[model samples]
Target: MLSYALLVHAAPYSEQGALSALRFAQAAVAQGHRVSSVFFYRDGVHNASTLMAPPQDEVHLAEGWRALAQEHGTELLVCIAASLRRGLMNAEEGVRHGREAHNLEPPFVLTGLGQLVDAMQANDRVITFAP
Candidate 1:
């Protein structure tokens, strides 16, 4: 099976980049390919925000991402620096920063760009979704 690594560089609701990446990943898995990892960078780190609450009429893009990650065993990695700048922090990070809340939770892990490089090295293909 072919292996893929995706880089998402747009906000979930601001553009279709994140959504497109999800669809691509779903299609890849449906076609028997493997999605090794999804690295959220720049504004794309907004996808990891836990405070997002879309209206019932609109699709919850984050749920779709979580579903894809769970069903496909794909890793969801967000850039630590980007996430922090965007206020998406895990528990440890929140405490370290003396923040009252942490928005990023399970299924999403904070990581460095080195993980992106690792993904590039490990996967057969790397796709970047830009705004």
Candidate 2:
């Protein structure tokens, strides 16, 4: 079984790239392949926002990704620089910026590009989903 790493660079609502990546990851796992990690970069950092509240009838993209991570033990990583630029912060960042709340929490970690490089080096295959 091949180990896969996914890189998503699109926002959930803005495009289908993230959704497609999720499906591919699920299918890969079901087929007995291992998914090492999912790296969210660029606008894709929006997927890690805890403030996302979609209509009940619509699918919650963030929740979907979170569930996948929970069930499959897949690492969910959002680019720190990209997330900061988009105002998506963890508790530490919120405290540093004098904010009362943070949008990124557990199951989604903020990391550097070095993590992406590491994923590429560790996984057997790296698939990128872009908008």
Residue-by-residue lDDT tens digits, candidate 1, 42-130:
99999888888989898787787888788888999999999888778999999999999899987999999999999999999999998
| Residue 3's lDDT in candidate 2 | 93
**Model 2 error, position 40 (Å):** 0.4
Cα deviation of 126 in candidate 1 (Å)? 0.2
What TM-score fits each model? 0.96, 0.96
lDDT of 2 by residue, 19-115 (tens): 8998898899999998889999999999999999989997888998898889988999999999999999999999999999999998999999999
The models' CA-based lDDT, in order, is: 0.91, 0.93
User: The CA-based lDDT of model 2 is what?
Assistant: 0.93
Looking at candidate 1, the ten consecutive residues that score lowest on lDDT are 59-68
Judged by lDDT against the true structure, how good is candidate 1? 0.91
Residue-level error in angstroms, candidate 2, position 6:
0.3
Q: Give me candidate 1's TM-score against the actual structure.
A: 0.96
